[model samples]
Target: MKRVIARCLIMVVTLLLISGCNTIRGAGEDIERGGEAIQRSAGG
Candidate 1:
């Protein structure tokens, strides 16, 4: 029972970390795209 609880906790933490990383990565991509769009508009 103790082992099961430990495993669950580890799984939850891992998932949270993964999700946080993904969110940051997604935000970075959005910013990059916005910059590109602005550059294109300015160039044209």
Candidate 2:
């Protein structure tokens, strides 16, 4: 019973970390795209 609980806790933490990483990457991409749009408008 103790082993099962430990395994579940580890799995939940791992999943949370993975999700956080994805969110950060997505935010970075959005910022980069916004900068490019600004430059394009200024140049044209």
Candidate 3:
């Protein structure tokens, strides 16, 4: 029973980490696009 519970906990943590990574990556892309827009507007 203990082993089953441990496995489930690990799986949940792993999923959460993976989701967090994707969220960070998406945010980075959004910020990069915003920066590019600013640069274009500034004629730089």
The 10-residue segment of model 3 with minimum total lDDT is: 16-25
RMSD of each: 9.8, 9.8, 9.3
After superposition, candidate 1 runs with Cα above 4 Å error:
23-44
The candidate scoring highest on TM-score is 1
In angstroms, the error of model 3 at 20 is: 0.2
Candidate 2's C-alpha lDDT?
A: 0.85
**lDDT string, candidate 2, 1-44, tens digits:** 99999999999999986775588778688778889999999995
Ordered from best to worst lDDT, the candidate numbers read: 3, 2, 1
Model 2, runs deviating above 4 Å: 23-44
lDDT string, candidate 1, 1-44, tens digits: 99999999999999976775578778688778889999999995
TM-score of each: 0.50, 0.50, 0.50
Worst 10 residues of 2 by lDDT: 16-25
Error of 2 at 40 (Å): 36
**lDDT of all predictions:** 0.85, 0.85, 0.87
